[model samples]
Target: MSENRLTNILVPVFAVILGIIAGAIVMIVSGYDPIAGYSALLYGAFGDRYYIGETIRQVTPYILAGLAVAFAFRTGLFNIGVEGQLIVGWLAAVWVGVAFELPKVIHLPLAIIAAGAAGALWGFIPGFLKARFRVHEVIVTIMMNYIALYVSNAVIRSVLSDQGFKSEKIHPSASLRSEFLQSLTDYSTLHYGIIISLIAAVVMWFLLEKTTTGYELRAVGFNQHASHYAGMNVNRNIILAMVISGAFAGIAGAMEGLGTFENVSVKAGFTGVGFDGIAVALLGGNHAFGIILAAVLFGALKVGALEMPSAADVPTELVDIVIALIIFFVASSYLIRLVLTRFKKEGK
Candidate 1:
């Protein structure tokens, strides 16, 4: 058991090391100082309280998005609709946020929950189709993504357009601000969403590892046929998994709008956070704690990359390249496993 655990940890670590080595080689070939560039990257990400706060801000949504993908993955589903769900969720949340006037406590949570419901409804269509008509989830999810983007743009134009491509700002009551912390941090964007995200991670971990529903989901994932034979409802589980996944993704959108942007803008384009969640989930090996760690890493990279071009003369695009390389190495972990096995055999 210890060896298995060690192998699992080392696999990801090795992947990261190899990715860094490959990135360094690329930097050298491009006539950049790899060491200095990396030093700047590290400093930019962790050098100050301001940067760290920004990193946490960026990580907030990533946690939800990562959980969305990881949860679906656990149930043998590939929910490519997270992008669409997030978009719709953002639109719904901000629409309600601006349209309502209520007490802070009631307004904020209600708008957020509305976002989750909207996202779940969007995901439910694909789930229904798959469960009833045997439709391929991959194709349905991809189509839903485009539909969501275009539909959202049209809604924004029709409903919120004041000759611009943006919606009205959310009501102050609906906003999730931490005035005390903001004052201390000089108005940094960090908000109460971080606490919500942490709670979500813990809840998801418990649901997946400790609950009977989790066992059913995993059993269905491992063998749907066997699950059905054992009196489990396969179709119901599939739909439930997708709905739950979409709900998490919706919360991601809510976090972005309520906590960060304070409103949804069609011109902001898709946050692509759903896609980024794929990388986070994969890099974290789909574990809840690992997902949090991975989200922070990616968040740090994003925040740090902004400072790179100005401080270290390295392009922000290089950071993307590094991330891609890391993802590639992670996806091909068998290569590292083989190498490790060879080394062990030789040593023996």
Candidate 2:
């Protein structure tokens, strides 16, 4: 493999390892057994059919969320507003699900499309500003996050909700839930969203790697002035890239609305799924397959953390610490690369 590819793979691996080691040290200092803690975590995430199902369920949205972030990153955009885009997408999907009475084939796809459209619209604003006026996307997207959060909550209360803080459950035609899958997994909330997420990963890969549009977007990301001089429409590519990125994020919301929850609920705070996507994309090196693997690891850790408290008497917060440490190491990857280069030189 090329040195860049090797570094990309090894960096995340080492980050995970170092994070786990640091967690063990913390556990030792707290008079807890690291082995027992990790064992419990593993069992919780994969030991039983139910846990396995839940892990997959958790992974579904994560894959799409990571894709959303990774897609924007590849196009040289930092889409911090994925949280907001996801919220609007969830609301849009739930709205479509409840309002429509079409056949299953039509209803399901329509609801999903509504989510993607909502997310795309949300994404377009910042893209427009960034492309047209050179406004920083980070600032625009961050503000939009709050707008999405409050606007969604208001819609739930005054528009979608009859008397409660949540919207009505979606119709069966629009639902992604499956009886056979549920029975197979001891009634865990696994759904067809996993299939959708996987398909999305493939779509991202094809769009970014196999198409002329992808080349233009990537070139714009590399250098806008150069790309423009090379005859690529830099502004259009930037806008298109953000729109596609937002669509991915919106589908992540559909995974929750149509698959897991079957409805949209008013939130006291942000969901954090969109925020976590940033880390997922970072750790995955902004590659489609890498993002899938990263999402799975994150899903496993999140699902497994629930077991730590009861199984090993370890605080669930320790898992959070480990995750934070992993991100820190990943962020400081230059140091890891420097060390690797030095070691290679000595060996030669």
TM-score of each: 0.96, 0.98
lDDT (Cα, tens digit) per residue for candidate 1, span 121-164 = 88888888888898988899889989999898888888966756
lDDT of model number 1: 0.87
Give the Cα error of residue 86 in candidate 1, in Å.
0.9
User: Candidate 1 clashing pairs?
Assistant: none
Tell me which residue pairs clash in candidate 2. none
lDDT values of the candidates? Answer: 0.87, 0.94
Weakest lDDT window of 10 consecutive positions for candidate 1:
263-272
Which candidate number would show the highest lDDT if scored against the true structure? 2
Model 2 agreement with the true structure over 1-348: per-residue lDDT tens digits: 697788789989999898899999999999999999999999999999999999999999899999999899988999998999999999999999998899999999999999999999999999999999999999999999999999999999999987579999999999999999999999999999999999999999999999999888888888989998999999999999999999999999999999999999999999999999998999898999999999999999999999999999999999989999999999999888888888888999
Candidate 2 at residue 54, lDDT?
A: 98
- List candidate 1 segments past 4 Å from native: 344-348
